[model samples]
Target: MRQGLGTQLRHLIDLLDGAVSAAYDEAGIDYRPRYTPVMRALEGGQPHTVSQIAEAAGITQPAATQTVALMIKEGLLESSPGVRDARQKVVRLSARGRDLLPQLHLCWQATRAAADSLDGDLPYPLSEALAAAIAALQHQPFGARIRKARAAITKETS
Candidate 1:
């Protein structure tokens, strides 16, 4: 049996994340690869709401909220209730997070260079292909395409 798109993508994620996580571990940094997006969003050194982080990080709001909670617990981030909307939480990088920036930036640069090398080895750059996929999905969501395919398959079986 052949692997599906989701399976292949998951494997790719596992490979990339495993390497990145290992690099961080080897560097003596207590950081998770999953925190990169949020870290990048917070590097401006300003407090932002979860929605803002989600938008900046290109992740879902729920994912942002969850990551925020984990980061806060890890001491990489601190949060307080929004001034205008007490229900909303404003998030900022903690002093601990700031301390890690110099090291993290170096690690990130090396990781990015490695990715560039991998891209060069391919006939098509993975980053370009990924960007194209994102654009296509934005134009017509995967759900809409799945529904159309499902309808056709059902009609044929019926």
Candidate 2:
């Protein structure tokens, strides 16, 4: 038995994320790679709801909510009731998060350069391949394929 694509992808992500995490540690920045998306989404200095953050960050609503809660606990983010919706909490960067942006931006640039180098070393760029896969999935989702395969299997068994 060989590892499946999902497992392989997770391994690759762990490797890349570990490298970035080490770099952040070296710089003495208390940040996680998971925080980047939310930080970038709030960079424009506007408070946004968790749903809005999820959309802007290209992540799930639950993931955004969890990240926001963690950031809040870390003193990097603050939240308040949404103006339009009392039940919705709007999130914004705290002073600590704002102060860390300059360092974070430098780290981001360096990380991009490193990723480019890695991509250059590979036979095919991982980022490009991932983008292509995502595009293909958007055109024909995996769920639909799974359903079709199940139907074929049922017909064969019948």
Candidate 3:
């Protein structure tokens, strides 16, 4: 049952990712969906340091730094000297990035609508259910124990 659930979850996630990729390609945006969460965090009218972005995006510092570097290179993000720590650069969306917000919204909306249509008459309750599931899973007790057990089983089977 666990394996079946995992497989279904993987399929759904992959399909969603593919949809996002197709939407971005159709919109002529050379960006990745992995960057969306971080970008949306910055779009909340807050300049964030690399560490802050890492925390907010639930990614490692180095991962955030690499993504930020790519965004900077693409002219989607810029950094300025930090207020207290001159060494830490604060990052925010560039003018061009801010301008792309509307287009991004439209593209995402269109993609979401298409996906929903494919699934037949859709409602909003799935989002709430998904959020609850994520919260429950993230806070689940014995998570490490379950993971260790799975690893042990995999090792033994292999």
List candidate 3 stretches off by more than 4 Å: 1-7, 55-63, 112-126, 145-158
The number of clashing residue pairs in each candidate reads 0, 0, 0
Instruction: Judge candidate 3 at residue 33 and give its lDDT.
Output: 79
Q: For residues 78-133, write the lDDT of model 3, one tens digit per residue.
A: 99999998999999999978888888888767867876675565555555666787
lDDT of 1 at 60: 97
Q: What TM-score would candidate 3 get against the native?
A: 0.69
Q: Write the per-residue lDDT of candidate 1 for residues 1-158, one digit (tens) a residue.
A: 99999999999999999999999999999999989999999998999999999999999999999999999999999999999999989999999999999999999999999999999999999999999999999999999999999999999999
Q: Model-by-model lDDT, in order?
A: 0.97, 0.95, 0.83
By lDDT rank, best first, the candidates go: 1, 2, 3
Model 2 C-alpha lDDT per residue in residues 1-158, reported as the tens digit of each score:
99998899999999999999999999999899999999999988999999999999999999999999999999999999988888989999999999999999999999999989988999999789989999999999999989999999999999
What is the lDDT for 15 in model 1?
A: 98
Name the best candidate (by lDDT): 1
Misplaced by over 4 Å in model 2 are 153-158
User: Whole-model lDDT for model 3 versus the true structure?
Assistant: 0.83
Better of 1 and 2 by TM-score: 1
